[model samples]
Target: MNLKETQKKFHKTLSEIYPKSEIDTFFYWIVEDVLQLKRIDVSLNPDFEINEKDLKTIKSQMNRLQQNEPIQYILGHTEFYGMHFQVNPNVLIPRPETEDLVNWIVSDLKHQPKKHLLDIGTGSGRIAIALKKELPKCEISAFDISETALQMASENAKQNEVKINFVQQDILKLDSLPEDVDIMVSNPPYVRVLEKEQMCDNVLKFEPHQALFVKNNDALVFYRKIIELAITSSKCKTVYFEINQYLKEDLKKLIQPYDINKIEFRKDFRGNERMLKLLID
Candidate 1:
């Protein structure tokens, strides 16, 4: 089929499941991934032909898309912090809100002395790798509970040409971190299990559960553990977390007892208080 015809069919199928605008973007991304053509090229050459084999593969992906499968999972990559990251079901797809957290950390480091940074619960090593790329002089280490996730993170570190010490250790254990870490950052599993009912079926069904859900009653388990660990084990200059939007006030109160220098609640692009930057002297 011609590129235009294929995209038309794909959009119609996807629009039945998702909004038309989103489906159009999805169609563009799929065509780009399969054909290695830019969006402008697709537009300029709408009559570009698709081989039967290639057409079959694209059709299979369309079927998955219609089933509400995420486009990132289909394409096996995502763009974050101006870099492409390999993604899969083993790790949570990096979100734009997390990019704000990365930018905040990088901006704060501009005036501070270069020191070691540790990324706890570093799934796919997105934050750690991004920080290391931007601040090449800083020492970086990242830890994840899932071996598969750590492998992906390690690969990403290599892909980004940033050296990160990727360790497969649970942050809850808090046993593997080094002393005198100047900064500790984490985007942990803060989504309470009970909140799964509210999540889209695509997310709940496809994404890794271990990377997304914490116990309902112990929703702040990761934050509490990481905070305690930072207090006792880190001589860190700062601690940052991409927090759950609903718990901003509660998180602020939770960290009040500590010797925090500044607890800045920053909003994401959508203006939701999605990240907390804590400076500890």
Candidate 2:
């Protein structure tokens, strides 16, 4: 079918599952992914025909989308910090809010002399890869509990042509590191398991649960563990986390006794307190 016809059909299919705005975005992304053509190209070349094989593949992808599978996973890649990274069920798909966390950390690092940076739970290696790309002189280490995730992160580092020490280590059991880090960052499992009832099927069903949810009784378990590690094991001057919006005040209170230089809570595009940057004293 022609470009316009294909888009119309795709929009209709997606709108059945998601809002019109999201459906439009999915339509544009699917077209771009399959045709290697931008929206303007589709407009200027309305008669562009997709081959039968490509149409079938696109339709299959749409079916997955309808089932609430993230488009990044469906496409097998996602753009983060202006670079493409491979994503799959083995790793949690990167989010725009996490991009904000990365930007905040990178902005702070720009003024400081280069030093070691560590990313805990480096799923898909998005944050570490982006930091390594932007701050080429800085030493970087990334750790993940999942063997699958670390392998994907290693591949991502190779793909980005950036050298990062990818370690398969659980933060809960980490010992002393090889060197003192200047900064540490993590977007750990802040979503409590009890919160699953409120989460969308796109997340709860398709994303890796171990990377997303913590035990209900201890919503801040990962936070507590990582912060303790940062204070004891890491030589970093600063630490950061992508936080759950509901636990902003609680998190600040939890870490106050540790003598953190500044515990700043920043809002995301949605105006929710979604990131916390803690400067370690």
Candidate 3:
């Protein structure tokens, strides 16, 4: 079938579940990824025929999309901070705000001396890998409790041509990390049980919830533990986190006992204060 005709069917199959804008995006992304057909090319040549195998692949992808699977997971990879990462159900797909958190650190450290950076609960190793790629001189290592996530991250590091040391350890049970890193970065599980209703099925049903939520009554569990590690380890000079949007003031107060007014928060593109940069005094 030709590209334009198939795209019409694609929109029809998915419009009931997703908006037309999203379906159009899916059509363009799959075409680019699979057929190497740029959007402009598709627009200029509406009758561009997709080969048989490609048509079959698109059908399969359409089915998955209809099932509410994320397009990134369906493609088995995603772009973050201009780098491509391998993603799966085992790891949460990296989000744009997390990219902002990464850029915040990279921009701050780009002109400075190389620092050792540790990423806690580094599912898919998005933060650590992006930092390493941007700041090549900096040493990067990441930790995750799930062996599956660590494996996926390791593959992404290899694919990105950046070497990152990935370790398996639960943040809640850490006595200390492998070595003293100068920077700690995390986008840990801060979602409360109550927030699930606010999330989409692609997230609640497909993404790894172990990396998304804490107990409803204890949404700050990972933050508290990591901050304690920062104090006790006395190694991390600064820590960056992509936090739950609703918990900004609570996070500020939670870290205040350690060092009052040492924390600064960054807003994402949407103006929610979703990124926190905590400095140890």
**Model 3 regions lying over 4 Å from their true place:** none
Each candidate's clash count: 0, 0, 0
In the range 124-157, model 1's lDDT, one tens digit per residue, is 8899999998888899998898999999998998
lDDT of 3 by residue, 43-151 (tens): 9999988889999999999999999999999999899988899999999998888888988998999999989999999999989999998999999989999999999
Question: Candidate 2 — what's its lDDT?
Answer: 0.86
TM-score of 1: 0.96
> All candidates: CA RMSD in angstroms?
1.4, 1.8, 1.4
> How does residue 189 of candidate 3 score in lDDT?
89
lDDT of 2 by residue, 1-281 (tens): 88888878878887768998888788789888887889888889989999998889888998999899998889989888898899999999988888888888888877788789989999999999999998888999999999999889988899989999998988888765555776788999888777889989888889999998887778888788777777775476678889999888789779978967787889988898999888777
Collision count of model 3: 0
| Residue 124 error, candidate 3, Å | 1.2
TM-score of 3: 0.96
* 222 Cα displacement, candidate 2 (Å): 1.6
